[model samples]
Target: MIPSLIRMARSRTYAEAINLLNTCQSNAATIEAIRKSGGRMNDYAIVEMNDYLRRIGYVPDDLNKLNVVHITGTKGKGSTSAFTERLLRTHMTGRIADVGLYTSPHLCAVRERIRINGEPLSEEDFARYFFEVWERLEGNTKTIYPHTPQFPIYFRLLTLLAFHTFISLGVSATVLEVGIGGTYDSTNIVPKPVITGITSLGLDHVAVLGNTIQDIARNKGGIYKAGVPALSVKQDQEEATRVLAECAEEARTSSYEVVPMIPETALGLRGAHQRINASLAVALARGFLRAQGKEGMDDALPRSFVAPLAGTKWPGRCQRVEQGKTTWLLDGAHTTESLTSCGEWAWGEGNKPGVLIFNCSGGRAGQMLLTALLEAGARTSSSELVELGKRFEAVIFCTNVTYTDGHFSSDLTSHAIDPNDLSQLATQNQLRDAWLELVPGYDPKQAHVVASIQHAVDLVRGMEGEHEVLVAGSLHLVGGVMEVASLQGSLGMV
Candidate 1:
């Protein structure tokens, strides 16, 4: 035990821990193994996640002490989680001592995934807790099962670490965001939460979550737990609404309500779509407070809620960074509906043609995402931004690889993408070709396929005039932009 403790305390820096975390990401082999497992990958996912929790020295019931507010959705889930955390931290002063937030697909740093009091865990803390969980898994590998590989995958391990960290820190409330679909996501191992929420639903991760909109709704609604209140914003499709209602009943939620959009008020996060997320957050916070026996939880918006809402900051969504002559508009909108919202916000915010830096995952339909963006821009009533042909000065497609050296920053490493696709620049080339076909009279010369994100930034930097640059499609791409352009300062990162 002394030797094991010493090994855990060995020279494990934050960087080294992050590199270890990167190794667990789902690569081709992981996916192929799941495919050969003979059913949906998610079939026994939560069961395995539960076992992982126990191996890490906790059970599903142990998470209940954190008083979690589990949130899942296709689009605005992260924003909703952010708003909920801020609301609890600010409004529930004496009752809720501390608030913890855990969200996914972090923009710049992995530390951003777990936060307390709205600040990410310090690097020292992140590493200390990361390896504690790591050693737990490593120590038990031979005992668990000899046939199956040990150590949970990237997201699962992170989830386990998050649970351990939150429990150890004694946070009073936890705003947990689902990494994928609600039902089988690693985060869903929590047997019960104080409340659960579903933000506006859309079709995303169809290959893994489900195929149709109803399937997507059912998967997201899986977060609804028996005896817990489930809240959602009005979905666009009635079929989705029906399916979600069914899920709530099936889960035996105490009550399932479709929350109305919050009154138009100042919001820290930009984009009109954020209002939906904010509204759901309001309901979840109120319900959780009531469950905690806090009084003065009125139905109407509280005076204390206003400031936190306006002050809330979820970086990388509807974010703008002004660097010299270039104004950068960045949003991680990969889905079609989200791209439409992104386009509308871009045109409404700056009614002028700009350079578009875009790339999507290999599996996504690039043309559809591009169409949603371009058509939304064309529909913008602003006369200056009305012409579809004039909407973009140039379009660039580049891999999410951070630097021109063909390497990823350790914190930004992703193994989910295909190695062959990355080597061939397949996704970028497809996006470039899609742009040419979509825009009539678009000069092929104006559409470029670059090998690295730094190349795209270099092109924008060398442009002759003041340019507005819109970076969208992938959060990984946005993080690469933030790294290459050194725009972390804009997001108030050190």
Candidate 2:
């Protein structure tokens, strides 16, 4: 029954499979089946996804048979991946050069994670690939050790699915993004990558990754395979230089050669930080070309790659939109450092009076971010900073920007107060008063909490104002803002 369901799901029948599961009676065997065969975090190790190539009877006879550029970092991984894919497609012609890109935390659709030449995988493709992988794992439940349905994790399944999809599709080159820390990431199964790229390191996911910069760097740098070329765009030159040096030394001694592929100038993305990202991409591309013995094959490589870097556009990173007299700028700067940098870049060296629509999840350093934004000259004396007290503005307008699980949606809005501020607003009246006071001019008749992010964007669009609508909060909000603006035909204006 489980095998059939898996097959059905793989054949673009996900809805049926899900419905069947819900209606089926709970049984130890059924649960065991899901536990054993379903996706798991460490399943990559148990399943040994790399071995599938032989089992499926497809073998690459040469080292140059497949080109892989592995990119991992704290930020800019998505943009770098997109830029690299676009550049390669534009330059590498006539070979049906398919570029496989896998990014994390989709903006609106899960299909957005996997792309071929800048286009996302379609819904049918996702369903088809998902079930195909599941079918392959069917009847081999015993092969999985200490199997637990919840243990292997969904992300592991996605990783294997991506690899299988890329290979089956005969992608010439695949750009894989490390889901988390690189060394143990499932994508690490790829053998002899053309280049390994790293983006700027920051303090994030502290509980899982590490508490300090070096600790995080060590984990991220784990993806640097021995003997493979590498590139990085770390801003703290000394820290980046030191970390890369250490990684290089370790890799060299272990038979892996590491090379510096920093960019010489800024690419298309905004902020000085992006210049580093472009550099990393450039370094990786150069190494890839050299490894393929295509170094001098095209004189356009240098110019073509560099030219696109400057004009390369990525949504939610200081994206701007104008509606009538009002200008909307969306940025997903959740951390203090990122917020400070973004505010500085947006407002420039001088202070500007602006309206800031801000909100944050529980664990983020919101207070610190607020302080940084204020110091960076973001707040106007008249601008209101409405912390989501008890009754936050009910309708949260989301622009198809990036978001996280910790972000507030209708499900968690009631409990979405800042963890640090939860103690202060214990009383109902206090919370209500705080919420009401935050909105500046509260009109309950016009107030309603919205479920969809697009609704909030529409509301903003209908408003009439010359003031810049600075959307500074989470990536989810930024995405929502962009999607709404795009719908209104104002996206490219940014």
Candidate 3:
């Protein structure tokens, strides 16, 4: 083992463990491997995942006892998982001891990814579980490729940790969200889930999953298991719908159903787009109950379901934080479809938008994201255009780096970004130029590109008066904004 891995395994505090965990993430190497795989990455993903799971003392079959509701999609997967977990927690009260939720790209802390009964694992528990997995993997001496790192990467390690945490906690039900595409995601090692769900599909993650919507659908459908009931939100694209149906058939799912949108209801998560997710969650939750021989609730919105759905608290997505004079609107909408919904939600919050803080991960289409937001704003406006020049008093584009010191928080550190791009502010500059071209009348002076999320927040804070600050684009960027802006308090109910 590497000396650092030994020290990381022996971390005494949650903070220390988090720092150590961050070091395990080999994003650059992972990207390189993916590139070299030539689109055949998914073939080996599960075989390797199973080996990692076995190294930590579990098998694919062992996870079946967790009664998981596996969920995946290009967008809305997190929200859908949140809704499903919340609903199950409420509906299964007393009947089930606890519910486990594991999602990705946590907003504030790494512990947010693993929750028990809607609460993030306490720092003590997180540290305890972190070391438990670390020690197990370190003690094991098995490897398919001895040259590769002995330990799994950050996400795989976390997925193993989540499984260990849930099983150790004796949780009866678990909601598992895919970290990436479905078929090969670390969470896909679950041999059987009570039910599986897919939210709205889009062309995100095209490079790895394939550039077409059909490819994305097939990659997502990898979550579907034989004899499992599979459900998805009604897709807008006919190609996606057809592909998903075919995938379900190929997987031999007990049944395949498309969930229709729920009428505008009192949902805890904001945005019109959430209704789609909410509808899917309802189906998954209900299907889980039936699969477990708990209850067969009909399509009608029962009080048990309604209350949890209303009280569901998904932080950082369509959230509004009121800190004195500033009303901060935060949504981690990285894809164009989700960003359009985010834009609509922002416009609905207020017409007099204050500052727009935006940043997408490297390689994403910044202009397309901006266009989605602007187009959504245009639809809600009576004018011909959303008048980007006046709508947003100022537009700030910045890197996801948490601080101006050119460092990321331990949990927020990302190695996937291109080093050259980060040094040159390449993506930020492109976004700025895209904005300038999109709104020609907009004053160049009003547009700013900064180095870090802290710089963006500082710029917003330096501005005078109370205004609505809309922060959207990448979830990492949103998480950075929450950290620097001290909006962590709004993680529950904003």
Top-TM-score candidate index: 3
Give me the displacement of residue 3 in model 1, in angstroms: 15
- Expressed as tens digits, the lDDT of each residue in 220-309 for candidate 2 is 676676677766674454665577668766765232323344436556566655655666666666666666576553442376576666
If both were scored by lDDT, which would come out higher, candidate 2 or candidate 3?
3
lDDT of 3: 0.83
How many clashes in each structure? 0, 30, 0
TM-score of each: 0.92, 0.70, 0.94
Across residues 467-489, which tens digit of lDDT does each residue of candidate 1 receive? 98999999989988998888876
lDDT of 1 at 221: 88
Query: Clash pairs of candidate 3?
Result: none
Give the clashing residue pairs of candidate 1, or none: none
- TM accuracy, model 2: 0.70
Better of 1 and 2 by TM-score: 1
TM-score of 1: 0.92
Q: What is the C-alpha lDDT of each candidate?
A: 0.82, 0.55, 0.83
Candidate 1 residue 459 Cα shift, in angstroms, is 1.3
Worst 10 residues of 3 by lDDT: 31-40
